[model samples]
Target: MAKDKIVLAYSGGLDTSIILKWLKETYDAEIIAFTADIGQKEELDGLEEKALKTGASKVYIDDLRDEFAKDFIFPMFQAATMYEGQYLLGTSIARPLIAKRMVEIARAEGAKYIAHGATGKGNDQVRFELGVAALAPEIEVIAPWRSEQFRSDFPGRAEMIAFAEKHGIPVTASAAKPYSTDRNLLHISFESGMLEDPWFDPSAEENEEMYVLSVSPERAPDQAEYVELTFEQGNCVAINGEAMSPLQVMEKLNELGGKHGIGRVDMVENRFVGMKSRGVYETPGGTILFTAHRKMESLTMDREVMHLRDSLISKYSELVYNGFWFAPERLALQALVTESQKNVSGVVRLKLYKGNVIGAGVKSPVSLYNPDIATMEADPSQAYDQGDATGFIRLNALRLKVSAGVNQSK
Candidate 1:
């Protein structure tokens, strides 16, 4: 009888390599390695062959960039999601889409089990498993980092390295760089290693060497560059007057934002597993989008609608950050978020300089602003009536004056 198949989310990285080896040896099962190509650039090159060499029975590489941007990223941006008031939620938003694709591949291949390389201590375990449970509840999830058998077999990175050598699997990791990284279209995140310390300044040589998508702000060019982004119903449709796909829009912004040293953040955040982790992120294109998207909303969104949407920003951000992308609450919130963006279509001009994205100008066909009403230099007979403010102020102040008079009598 043939062994049962297990589909593993393989990245051609050190941790996943160890998992692939262990899965084959322990279960004697057929291992099918999967890599999602969500804009990791050239890192996907040679991955399929590498997985086969590392004991995978077969390999699947799927290009998921356009879906990643349009379905996942654009919706998150439409809601104006930001985690902990600073993070753009780049890494957090990519998890569900990857998990969704993994589940789909498992069903197609008739795999009974799936595996991932996320550690027990990190948020990814929650993210990967929650997605699995939601999408493929019957499929068993094999998490090597949390398994006692795997941990006993290889105590740490050194043992895993030795096991790879014994199996003739070439690995690129070193002891000096203990931190693991995950990269996709939106951002790259660095955690563990020297970054574990909250006080550790990331400007150290070793830390600087890890950057892939952006440069240091100090080294950015002296000149500034301007770019115009056009949105259609909350989706980025063009850049600098040229029509482009979502993937192309992100690529253009990444190039421009990287050149200007934009989008670098270091923060200590509360993890879903009841602990805090320090992470450094580089999200060049994501930062540019956040800035320009807000400018678009300012022009097209109604005042009360913007305020109501802003009220949900915290809860919405927490759901994304906490691995609840497939949860019912998040889906419902997204429905409202999507409706709120119906009129958010416009062009936002921005100035990109060293580590800064400054709004240059914004305009939209549906803009609520009227020069006749807003401009003090406009004729009093036009648009808004200035005389209406007298009754409006008295009506609003009635309760305040009553409370003040009652207090004075006491």
Candidate 2:
């Protein structure tokens, strides 16, 4: 008789390694481990060998960096999506892509169940489960952290460590690292552990070593550097005269932005799980691209179209943050975003100085700003009629004037 097969989203981390073994023991099933390389750097090293040694019948490490940058990061930036007006949604955005690939592997391997290491108290479990439901409704999810049997078996880290030791599964995780981090092409996020304290200062000198992608603002170079970006249809196409693919663009910008200590944010944001979580993030490339894109839009995007699109940004951001990337409502919002960017082709220059992305200049062929009509000097063309302002102001103020008169008469 053949055993049931379960595909697990494995990172070779302590939690995932333990879960890999636990799933096999609990279900008497064959375990296939899958890892997605979306630019997590050196974390991918020796992952396959480690997974196989830890009892995975098969292992897969897929590279999705290009797809992640172009399909996910660039599209989100086109709308300038930000959660709660500050966070770049770095960690929130990566979950769906990871879950998407896991489902594909599950189907190919004839696995009916997909398991993940996301804890029930956090948002990632919601993200992973929702993504699987949306993409493959028939597949079942096996989340051990949320399972009563698994929770009862391993009550804490001590029990988990003992289980791994008894099984000879090597683990490097320990209490030494105070916070947890998630890294991708777009950004690196640090949260939990010491960061859970709302009043704790991540910028303190003691915690300075925690930042991975950027230097401290105080230690950045005094000289300001200028960078030029070209955009077409709301996507960054080039940087400093070098035309590059989305992945290449992100890599180059990350280097530049990191040198100047740009794109560091620390804040307490409301999570979809109804709790406030504090996180520190370094999104150097994303911040630079976001600033440049907005400047370019100002030059070429129409007034009313920009206004209408801006109104939906908050809702659009919420959808992405809450694991609705595959939902119908988000697709409708993205359609409006795409139409608004038809004319948003332009060049923007910015000055990067010690974490500041300052606008230097912007120009576009389809620019709506007519100097002749907007200039303070005498217009020989007589482009804008000065006399038109009288009726424009009177017509707009008529209702206000009537309301005042009614109040006075009363």
Candidate 3:
């Protein structure tokens, strides 16, 4: 008789490792561990060996960096999408891609069950489950953290550590260093553990090691550096006039933006689960992209179209944050966003200095800005008559004038 196979989304972290062991013991099933390399840097180091030793029958590590940047990050960037006007949706964007790969691997490996370590209280569970449902609805999802039996058996992290100890599973993190962190190419997010305290100021000493992409802002170069970003149909194509691929463009911008200590944001954002959580993020590449794209749009985008798109930004941001990336409403909004960017082609020069992204200048072939219409020095005779302004103002202010007259009469 053959044992049933379950594919686990393994991160080699304490939570996932413990869950991996627990799943193997509880289900008595063959466990296949899957890790998605969406630019988590050193986090992937020795992950295969770690997963295999910890009870995984086989381990699959897929490099999804190019796919992550090109498909997920770039589309979100093109939309100028932010979660609650702050978060760049770093972890949110990475989840769908990870889940998609998990489903693919499950199918290839002939696994009947797909498992993840996301807790019941968090948004990741929804994101992962939704992705799986969208891609492969037939596969059974076994979320250990949300399982009643698993919760009763372990109760908490202490019990999880005890289980690892009993099973001789090598666990690196202890209660002493309890903060949960999620890292990727775009950003690193810190939450849970010591961060639960709303009033607690993040211990600067403890957080010093958290930075992966750049040096401290205090140590950034004193001089400002200018860089030009070229875009076509809302996608960034080049940096400093050097044409590059989507991944290359992001990598180049990350290098430039990191040197100046750009894109570090700390905020308490409303989670999809109706909880307010504090998150610290570093989005160097995304920051530069946003700055340059907005500058380019200012030059090329029509005023009415820009305003209409701007009005929908909050709604769009909320949709991405709330794990609706695969939803029809978001797709409909994205189509409008893409259509709005049809004319948003240009080069934008930005000055990066000590965490500041300052717009230097912008130019576009499709620019709506006309110096002849805008410049004070332009010939007045060539433009519309000044006398037409009197009637225009009077007509516009008629209601206000009527109200004033009525008030005087009263």
Q: Give the poorly placed runs of model 2, Cα more than 4 Å off.
A: 156-172
Candidate 1 overall lDDT versus native: 0.89
Model 2, span 155-211: residue lDDT tens: 766677778889888775556664667788989988867788889998888888899
- Best-performing candidate as measured by TM-score: 2
Q: Distance (Å) between predicted and true CA of 392, model 1?
A: 2.4
Estimate the lDDT of model 2: 0.90
Clashes of 1: 0
Q: What is the lDDT of residue 286 in candidate 3?
A: 84
The better candidate by lDDT, 1 or 2, is 2
Q: For residues 300-358, what per-residue lDDT tens digits would candidate 3 score against the true structure?
A: 88899889988988888877777778888988988999899998898999999998999
Q: Which 10-residue span in candidate 3 carries the lowest summed lDDT?
A: 200-209
Task: Using TM-score as the measure, name the better of candidate 1 and candidate 2.
Answer: 2
**Global lDDT of each model?**
0.89, 0.90, 0.85
**Local accuracy of candidate 1 as per-residue lDDT tens digits, 232-351:** 888889999999998998999999998988998889988889998899999999999999999999999999989999999999998988889999999999999999999999899999
Tell me which residue pairs clash in candidate 3: none
